[model samples]
Target: MRNYVGAIAAVCLAACGEPGGTDVSSAPGALELTREADGAASGAWGQGEARVRFASRRVESGVYRIEVRQNGMSLTGLVDAEQGVSSLDGFAEDNGQDTQMLDGDRELLAGLYAALGAELPAGSALAPELKYLRRAVGLWAEHPPAVELQRTVMGEQGRGYTMLCGYAKCNGKFTGSCGTTFNWYSYAKHDCQHGGFDLAANQQIAQLGDHATCDGDELYMSGGKWVCGEPDHQSRPKVQGNCFGRCGPGCGGDTQYTVDATNHDGCVRNGHALTSAYCNDQFTAASDDELYAPDCY
Candidate 1:
């Protein structure tokens, strides 16, 4: 048995913004392998703005294989600061295992050639009577499962993170390899771990503790945590407003609003306002750190 593994990472953007975001879109269809000529093959796929190629080889009599091996992070625009690294590996093998043996007859080779979309030769070890064998088996072998690592920013602040990594084996038995595996992980600003946080809020304020005020009001009493703003209040301060001033509209976190008493308010003490308003830094930073890894088989 031969051991094989490969990785392919891609981030297809619509020529507008970052590699992984709402604006990004993926092209239809998966990568494919095909015979280019007698005893020759090719593998083709697209990633970002470029095309990628893998090497193919003829291993034995009537047996061919193709392989691409690499870490998912190496690909441009595939991985980013917030997104962790990933990998993929697999192989493609084609052998006439299902076809009946032709006892060293050249006619058997001719049939194989026809099955691969090649013109039959005038004279060969295989006879014209055995030409039907060519159509019996498909040209390319079954591809092994490609590995995938999908990293997503979770939670209201995007402070929470999760990575889903898995492998999907091919369905055909041309080779013995086939199956799937999945793993998950979570991380926060202080420490990278496993799990997530569920937040709660009311119409006026997002109360993580005792005390209430309008969203984006800069809760001096609440240790400076930013609120996501009330959905019902038209005047509610923007959530993740920190990035708005710096990154502009092209970056994540950009929106406008009308200030109203129901949504706007500044903390006050002794007839004077206290703490100045500031957006949550964590959410804005995380939004800028969109990253992704591809699935390859």
Candidate 2:
């Protein structure tokens, strides 16, 4: 699955010495590999046509544990160069895309691939698309809904209604990933004064990883904020970068709320309030007068 915020970058460079430079041929060390298949166990070195070659130089003078096998059959065995001994382990099978060792053994898989001078199988059928969608759903669950809640509350003079909403940000574990966006709207009637509100907000929390990009009508609503323009990918924070760093200054925990009449022509004269808060956090309550509007005919 595409990781959200915690996806680590490729570490092959740091772990493996400059690619294509590490020589395994001249290593002076003993390797012992075993393979099991078809109700029989065998050594890994000097087996049938499918065998792994052992090569090591300037290493420990003791024996090393290794095993290789495929389809319940022995393919190659470990080698003791100093002792001049070789054995077989299991057989290899061609599974179309790449060679696969039936047993649940990676060492055997690597050995067989090395012997054949080919890459190992990709392993498993969890495609990239399914993995990412699952992650996006999980992120949405943690944060508060971006839509404003309109409720009726009892007051001294009579019953009053209020509208509330805010912005929320969800961090994806993987880097360079993108997510889907959504929009919402609502209307209501109370005490003879027909009331309605409309706003637009964009949600990119789902695609924070997988390096996905989106652009279309650009109409979206989230946390009471409206976004109509396209986001600049080049300047935006990447999923692989520091999550916390992008949380504030970069992503800017800001939510914009605006009140509009049922006509939807313009804001309710004075209905825009700007607030600052972290993504996924709740919005503070506003006075009834600040959000409530009387009948407008």
Candidate 3:
């Protein structure tokens, strides 16, 4: 999924600033998707500067024209429910003063068109048709969870450390893959001492270990030792007070917050693995590391 944090930043840079100059400190909050009695739908996030408006009017039997006004750009698409197709027909800017061919990812517009055509009744009023389109737009506009990163910095006089420091490194890595497998194992009674004997001849059984001597991909160093095991982690110092910041007036920066380091459970956001929830969850999925019986270890 495309990173919408960048989108919010773009909107803020364009409109969210101190009255005279461009200076912004806050990030946008969740999108506000709303519908009007006229069946027109609008979604605004990142304050009100970044906005999208959807309006549709039925043409004839299972066909409708969709107009999307997003920020300063206007996109038009046609939906034919009977044919099960949606296509971007035109694009314009500055209230249609400048027109150009539609380009780039028009899936959002097409999806909205198809959804509207399928849901809205024939000859239905504009308001009801756009209401459904609003929901689709809202889903597409849903923001990923805001992640907060904590960095350690020495306090003045080298006394203590502050938990929240600097920009908080908004962009961070998500969990990829994880599973603790042991390289340690034991063999049972195998009488393969003779060259004529098979390697597995008379091997009763095998044993596994609970502790991970080394991972499958770990390389062996001198003295037959693993390069490393699970690295040790230091516990975080207890934070005394809450840390909260607000966005500038009329900006959508309020919905943005830092994600704690421990919330990676593999759950998805915006149809993408933006967090480490999946891999982290796998670490605990199977608690029994020993493949064989406990006594076999």
Highest-lDDT candidate: 3
How high is the lDDT of residue 249 in model 2?
12
In candidate 2, what are the lDDT values of residues 111-170, reduced to their tens digit? 332322121111223222211111111111121223221112111113322222211122
Model 1 gets an lDDT of 0.22
What would the per-residue lDDT of candidate 3 be over residues 140-174, giving only the tens digit for each residue?
22212221111111111111111111211221111
What TM-score should be assigned to candidate 2? 0.14
Cα deviation in Å at residue 186, candidate 2? 10
In every candidate, how many clashes are there? 14, 61, 18
TM-score for each prediction? 0.16, 0.14, 0.26
Q: Worst ten-residue run, lDDT, model 2?
A: 1-10
Model 1 regions more than 4 Å off: 1-34, 69-297
Model 3: CA > 4 A from native = 1-48, 95-297
Query: Tell me, what's the RMSD of every candidate?
Result: 24.7, 25.5, 23.0
48-68 per-residue lDDT for model 1 (tens digits): 344333333333333222222
Better of 2 and 3 by lDDT: 3
